[model samples]
Target: MSDSLFLGIDSGATTSKIAAVRDDGSVFPSELLQRPTGSEGGPEGVIRAWMRAIDEYMAEHGIKWSQIAGVGLAVPGPRRSYGVLDSGPNLPDSFNGWNVEQDLISALKQASGRMLPLALGNDGNMGGVAEAHHAIGDQRAGVVMLAPGSGLGGAYIDPTGMCLDGDHLAGMEVGHMAAPLHLLDVPALTCGCGRTWGCFEMYTALAGLPDLLNLALPRYPDHVLADPSLGKKERVLKLRGLAQDGDALALELFDLQAKAMGLLVGQLAMAVDPACFVIGGGLIDPDATTEAFRSRYLGGIESAALAYLWPTQRETLRIVPASLGEQSQAIGAAHVARLTVKAGSSVQPFSSTSR
Candidate 1:
């Protein structure tokens, strides 16, 4: 342990990742811990699980409350205010309008007999923060990150390593941005966000794969993924295996996904003109597949994006995979906590009347 450490917790729909980061923003892989989020039990259960993980981690590592400078939590939904969520759609209904920061701090005080400063951040934004500081390391360059999973989430990290949340703290909802439906030759389909027309998320998210497959399956009835016996979950797994085996249909689906990604990146370039784009989330997980598929997918994205980018922009913009993988959000949260404590704002003792 260093003289002072920051604790970061990334609370996802299924898992909560906890990690300790040093002042220099270095996190040991061995110190990373993942626990079930206990979301079925709602907000309290989730908070309790995090507390237990923190308690277990500290006990195992011989860390004391005095050694922890602050804590940061990365959550999935939009923030209503600092330390609170407007709604946690991916989580249980109970998390809606929850003050996770205050509750977690209260739990820490009860369990550890001390109050620590804690900060809250959107998970997607936190991922970008981690990449901006730890992965890219160029303070002069802006970075935009797109995380394609069940839904598409995005974040913009400015040159100074701040995640831009805009005036209402609801900026960077890139997934809901209107997509070029013509590029995909798909009808204007409603997005999960309830948009009547196509959105970027409808074309690239895992949730949209089934719709894509349904549209394409008629042309390739014999496709392994078209088996009537296969359920949605199994079909995704089978598709990955097929992709690894170089199945044409699987490759085509991924290519279409890449094309949508490229268009989204190009559109973002015109708006943010980020120095680079970092692609992360479950969609890009290597999962034992050979690099060939990943390369092809990424290559397709770059090629398509270049067609849409300005000539001057084409030379400077780069697209890369997230280096930190699953740990990115946790590390970013820890970094945010460290920054919060250092700035001497949003650091406070637990007060029952604070809300």
Candidate 2:
């Protein structure tokens, strides 16, 4: 380990990612640890899993906490009230009252034997930062990140190429916005967060898309729609098979997903008018066949007379897939650690015991 290694952690629903970067901008896969977020066990279980992973990685790398610069974490939900995660309905009950930022800092202090400068922010904002620094290249300012995974997560990158982490770290909740559900009688889209009939998440999130597809095709008999046991990988593969076999239902479903995604991106473009939009997630198939996802997402941006929208005279929106693949959040967290370390002149001691 370098003398001043900065660590970044991207914690997602499935796996937790960690990366370390040296001062020279050279990055190494410090450790990639996979653990159940234990959302079922609640927030404390999630925190335990994370800490255990870090400890295991440290031991494996023969790295000590004192040699490390700082740690940055990319959390899933909006930071409510002093960096507490109150609205993460997916998180276990234990997380309801936990102050994530403060708790993590204390934990790291005990583990590292030094006060670690901690910076906690929304995962969406970190995704934006990753896009700006790694994907946008020369086009730094005015970038928006559309992380299309379980749902649509949004992040805005400013002129200096830094994502505004936002007050309480609630930068964007694009998935929670109202989306169209022409097929449903209720017309309201339901979200995983328990809100009904809104945003593309109702139809696009990994858990929600299959049900939406089934609902979209009410004409088909109820027994024909399979068990709906399809995961993201399986769903994408199914779409490819359907598209290959000329299945009209698959085509329609994919198109609907694209349009819903596009409209949401359009709304984001209207708000920020970014120079480029970076899209990322499991829905994006590697093969060129899924280019429609990119095109439809970009084509949805069709509004005029707004100064904030990019290209005042002409529509100049560039929608590109994310460059970092699945590691974007982890890398972004590493940058966060670097910044935190740079901001603080001295390292503080970590309290050995939990509060």
Candidate 3:
């Protein structure tokens, strides 16, 4: 078992990342591999791109399928079952009815000529698992993770580092959760989830940035970001650079983001009473400028959240950035695969109809 390796794949709409982990839960970031998702080709093409990334990684590192103990794949969107997705908002319509887990398994067998144990999990839940056990290493207290990327996603990990998926397996759809819109003093905006108003993601995620900027741009006509030629997404992405340069409008946007995040965390804290809350995803960058902005933003969140909590809760609650950074999802998926194998579940030779 010392030499055994578990493979973790984080399959996102834009990119697919792969990493191998040892039995002891260690992984080399240098060995991580990725490829464009190639969603234009549909489900089969996306899976093939992922498989090619794995194949190239193994060949480059001299790894063989015989030494691999298990595999885990993390995917986005709501699940109808273990490996079947109900719909993928960021993915092409062709993938809506696909059983991604079974397809990946068949592709693996064809590529590696082995039926390895595999586990499929939601990307948010897998990130929580990694943060709870490997990154934060707090096995005694429950952990909650809120990842703000193109959209917001979350997961709850019990004290034992197991993710709680609930009866429907859609338990942690935090993005669609109703928020306290009145707290922000802004008009309620509809979310992609079809909520008429007040979805948390509508205030905090990248998808929501355009609306946020729209509200701000009216007052800052002279600002460089206010140029009509820059698309909404481009303007949103450029806000960070402006914030880095101490631009007032950009800083204000981040401040609003912090307050919204605080409100979301406060809501979760009251409901779940988790010991710690970890913030991850694209918004939480490791670069110096981003780190400085994140530090200030976190301070604002803490202040806002503290106002909503009792003294005891305030003293005990912890909010921190994700330690594993970009590698969290992949490392977490590998960790889940290892756990599945340890539970004595048979994942190899899986049937298309099976979980």
- Model number with the top lDDT: 3
The C-alpha TM-scores of every prediction are: 0.89, 0.75, 0.88
Looking at model 2, which ten-residue stretch has the lowest summed lDDT?
346-355
Candidate 3, residues 182-205: lDDT per residue as tens digits?
888777878887887678887888
The local distance difference test score of model 1 is: 0.80
lDDT by residue (119-187, candidate 2, tens digit) is 666777876777777765545468877776656777887865567765544557777778656532324
lDDT for model 2, please. 0.64
Task: Supply candidate 2's per-residue lDDT for 78.
Answer: 48
TM for candidate 1 is 0.89
The 10-residue segment with the lowest total lDDT in model 3: 346-355
Candidate 3 Cα errors over 4 Å, as ranges: 38-42, 109-114, 218-222, 226-230, 348-355
Residues 98-175, candidate 1, lDDT per residue (tens digit)? 878778888977865777787777888987888777657745788999988888989998876778866676789989
Off by over 4 Å in 2: 1-3, 12-15, 24-26, 36-48, 59-62, 180-198, 203-215, 218-241, 287-316, 340-355
